[model samples]
Target: MDHYEQQALRELQQWQIRMNKKPSLFNGLTKGLQNKVNNVIPDKIHEIMTSAIKNIVRAALLGSEFTTKKEVPSGLSLAERERLVRERLRFYKKAAATEGAATGAGGLFLGLADFPLLLTLKMKFLFEVAAIYGFDIKDYRERLYILHLFQLAFSSDARRREVYQKVLNWEATILEFPSLQAIDWRRFQQEYRDYIDLVKLLQLVPVVGAFIGAYANYHLLDNLGDTAMNGYRLRFLQQITITPK
Candidate 1:
């Protein structure tokens, strides 16, 4: 391997170790508390929330709304592709922050609107990142990988490890599922909602809502960008190792 590839492999190995680490006591307690809160909610409410997230995400996966026009030029190195990925990430983070500020300034209704809008921005950013890494977003498996990557980013510590395992063995894991419908939508939605609920709730406050919204969205995108780069790095480095010399 060249110097850059060797460096990337080291980084990917570190990320893998972090992904596999067990949740701390505090993380476990927080997850327990969230579970307790979820248990008290009515089944119908859970169904509604899960359905909403499922439909929105499914639509994004199947629809053209997030499709990118830019194609990765053939023969670009992983490092070059990641440079473009970082640029797109910066652009999306700014857009998400702007959208968050605008909606947060509006009121309860507008603050509520931020969920789908921010989700759209995130999904679109993932599509662009996948393209930059030379993955064919048109394939169902690739899109499924995107969804898992999203889960890995937003899930709680314990759940994150579980999702990370799936990401690590995606080729074999994907074979076990017949279709996207097999996904645990309820768990997926709950984990995501729980992860951001605190900051998002703050975004409903009148005066400080805009600032909180902007800051929250920017950091959330920043986290996602980091997770995505490492996620793709796993694939990139693996491909390099397995390819014929």
Candidate 2:
């Protein structure tokens, strides 16, 4: 293997270790707190949020609305493709941060609007990233992979490990499901909502909400970008045979 690929493989290994880590005491405590917060939230609101995520994600998977016009040029190296991916990620992070700041400053009503807007931005970014990785987002399987990556990035430690294992054996796992309808979207939405609920609640407050919103959105995107890079790296490296020296 080339120097850059070797470096990428090492990084992927470290990420795998992190993905497989057991939840710590702190993780358990935070999860408990988040669950309490979710419990206090009205079931109607939870239903609304879950429905929104399901519809938006389903539309993204089944439609071409988020597809990029720029094709990944043939024969680009992994390093080259990743450079473009990073550039796109930075752009999306800035856009998300800006959206978050604007909505946050406008009080609770606008803050509520951030959910769909931010989700669209994230899904769009993933589509662009998939293209850069030379994956055909037009394929349903690839789109499903995007959802798994999203779950991996935002779910709690235990759920993250479960999703990570599916990602690791994606080729086999994909076959077990007959269609996208087989996905447990209720669990998916709940995990994602619980994951972001704490920080997102702060965005509803007056004055300081703007700063919190911007920081949270940027940080979230940054985390997702790293997860996506390593997720794709796992697939890429696994597809090619690397001889040990």
Candidate 3:
């Protein structure tokens, strides 16, 4: 048509192109993060969860004898998720200062008690929180898939395999354990009833828990492993006092 119409058409086409590129751009970012974990700082995978003080406390408090009575959902609520991460970091720092200890080389022996049913409840909580904050996910499915990939890839295979069997060990007590397919739902509910209650309580705060949940889900379930790996790699990169000629 005219010059003005041509300009408008060009702008519209540019917007369309951007919209089309969005998914790939997001996936590329996700993949980049995943690569850092898979290739660079592979050791940092389980360290994030276990090297913290709160984790030890939870393990001690929950005890090896604890058992769930129902199916526990496989995610966390927002506030609880935030609390979980913050507490873990806090504990990690305190442990480091007090003990001068660090996450041991090679994956630590993590059992169901290590990851905990609370973490799963926290994940589900995060989903609701994201929704409350008007967060939409074109690439959520991709992120979730990638999260699983990271979990599977960087995780200690021995421990991973052990936990898979333990999921069966508590089959009656815990519900819908994370497997190739969803396990029993009723057990999942009973297993994480406390976490569910906490999620419900946090819901009373309107979108506060939801906001925390959204970020935690995006970070932990989506980006934490890769982020931790990247951080470690960046640290190593910065350690070069001199470059080779």
Candidate 4:
């Protein structure tokens, strides 16, 4: 490995160590406030958001339609895989930024529409990233890994660590991770929505909405893309240690 690849591997190891560590006291406090906020949200809105997010994610996990990701050339090295991943991230970031700008400029009605549209963009980008990493998204575990990456990005600090541990243990459990419906969809949706609530809400305001939407969506994609790259990196290096030479 050259300088960059060695540095990346070292960083990935450190990241996993951080991921596996238990949440700090500050994390607990933040999550507590998040819970308080979630509690005040109307049950009807919670139910609606939960139902929508669950259905959309379930479709991504179980439906072939979501896997329209074309085949990537196989047998790329770690550096090559990440190079491809960066390429995909660049494209998705711009698309998300543009979508956010358009919807944000359209006022509250269209700003509301950005939620689902942006979700679509995020999911599609995950599909492409997984393919570039040489994983078959048709497999249930890989799809679940995609969801785990999503949760890692947007969940509270406490849940993010928990989710990352799951990602680390995935290889051991992927074959037996139970049914998709077994997940706590309510918690998943609430955490995600609450995490982005304030910023996304700004996207609904007049005049400033367009800038907030574009900037928020752009950075959201940036964060998600980074999380995903490390996630796949974690998997790749772990497999390397186990593979028979």
Per TM-score, the best of the predicted structures is 2
Off by over 4 Å in 4: 1-4, 17-48, 242-245
Q: Write the per-residue lDDT of candidate 2 for residues 103-207, one digit (tens) a residue.
A: 999998788888888889999999999999999999989999999999999999999999999998898989976788889988999899989988878898899
Candidate 1: which stretches are off by over 4 Å?
A: 32-52, 242-245
- Can you give the TM-score per candidate against the true fold? 0.90, 0.96, 0.20, 0.87
Q: Give the TM-score of candidate 1.
A: 0.90
lDDT of 3 by residue, 59-135 (tens): 32233322222232344333333344444444433332222111111123321122333353333333332222222
Which candidate number would show the highest lDDT if scored against the true structure?
2
Summarize candidate 1's per-residue lDDT along 1-245 as a digit string, tens digits.
77877787777778778888889999878877776766765675455446667778888677776678976798999889988998999999999999899999997778878877888888989988988888988887888899999999998888999999888887898997678778777788888888886677679789899999999999999999989998888887778773211
What C-alpha lDDT do the candidate models reach, one value each?
A: 0.84, 0.89, 0.31, 0.81
Question: Residue 53 in model 2: shift from native, Å?
Answer: 0.6
Comparing candidate 1 with candidate 3, which one achieves the higher lDDT?
Answer: 1
Worst 10 residues of 1 by lDDT: 236-245
Candidate 2 Cα outliers beyond 4 Å, as residue runs: 42-44, 243-245
- Scored by lDDT, model 3 comes in at 0.31
